[model samples]
Target: MARQLRERAEQHTETHLTLRDLRHVCWDPVPGAVVYVCENPRVVEAAADAGMDAGLVCTSGNATTVVHTLLTALVEGGTRLYVRGDFDWAGVAMVERLLTRYPAQPWRMSAADYEQQVERARDRRTPLQPLEGRPQTASWDPELAPSMNSFGMAVHEESALDLLVQDLRQRP
Candidate 1:
């Protein structure tokens, strides 16, 4: 399923816009529309398999030119963007980027959400290193980055997939 979504996302990129050209386009979701964002291919695949009734796009780990282009277009189109990613540093970074680049709503990517998931973690002893690139503030939720830093561990979005899907289903 992941592969299929990846392929689709890639194909979408081939015909649409490359990541480099993202800055030139605008990606705004329609009012009340939901656009799912993720760092992993599997999540994209699952969403695709479930039938993406809403606007959906995959970042495929880090915002590539294609991901940026699609997201920008959605924002310009006035579509509401919902982003979810690994709970780790990279995830936070990705969320930060999305929030900064696009007017996106937080999709369970919060400190409270992280705390709940942390309580459910199987192994909590291993401390995660801070994400290396330029750290960007999470404009939507300021406390998120700090909370992750305090916890010193990474959380993958897959861990919270059920919560995200349930939330998406409830949205009209």
Candidate 2:
């Protein structure tokens, strides 16, 4: 499946396929396929280096037009996306955007998950100002936003990666 996706992406690039054109290709279902959404290249690189077997795709931050096209293709093919990002407003916003675009399961981004991590947080930093925007209800788990607000700090997904990788390893 990964090879097929890579080939499709390469073909699309070589042919200069428009986003509209790429959108029409239905992706085959890759059950348990996981896509990591991150703003940082290191996260993507690390995931690759660690040989994480999920169908990983790097968002490179805000979804570029290409990333959007790729994700659309992946979702259409039945790939269930799992996202992780910085636990700030921007990260939340990115998750929201992807949720809007594709059907995705929250990857340890729930309120309960955050609470557990918060309890273990060392050298915790206070949330920065300009917290005016409302957080969206997590589609996979509704309590996530409220928990984040109540905690008054952002817990980046990277900080909880060990737990995430463990969960991934255990996925059927």
Candidate 3:
């Protein structure tokens, strides 16, 4: 299964695995191997376009059972996971849940990254929607929540695609 996944990634294809597909298969990752998970499909698409061989998974918003199953398999096999999402209340909540449940680290989902993106948005004159819903705290980074609440804007994953793709390219 790991070989097959690598083949698909080598071809720059987006492979969507269902819960049924992963139920009986084991993803025996290379020890200490890294995989990136994100909330939106656009990041995956962008990575594909860049022909990145690094493993990337998209949850398409809040993770479904399929996402959980895939992540569980990789994590159990000793794969290091880096996850990111939109800079919004709901996105933070999703990240919080994943980080709490898995041994995953935040992938550019920090307060500093948020502030940089906010500045980029402003410089580009791209209008960001005001944050909605209740504020969410990021346990991994103590300053993340306060920084986000102070900005009062939401930065979608699309805005940071270039940085993400660049990171993927740099992965060993």
lDDT of 3: 0.90
In model 1, the Cα lDDT at residue 8 comes to: 60
Root-mean-square deviation of Cα positions for candidate 3 versus the true structure, in angstroms? 1.5
Give the higher-lDDT candidate: 1 or 3.
3
Q: Which stretches of candidate 3 lie over 4 Å from their true place?
A: 1-4, 24-26
lDDT of 1 by residue, 1-172 (tens): 3344347655543123454545553333356566777677666555545554444566778987677767666666767788878877667777777777777776787789887777656454434444454344666678877777677667676665666656656765
Clashes of each: 24, 2, 0
Model 1: lDDT equals: 0.65
Which 10 residues in a row give candidate 2 its minimum summed lDDT?
Answer: 8-17
Higher-TM-score candidate of 2 and 3: 3
Which pairs, if any, clash in model 2? 27-77, 28-77
- Pick by TM-score: which candidate is best? 3
| lDDT-based ranking | 3, 1, 2
- TM of each candidate vs. truth: 0.69, 0.68, 0.94
Query: Candidate 3, TM-score vs. the true structure?
Result: 0.94
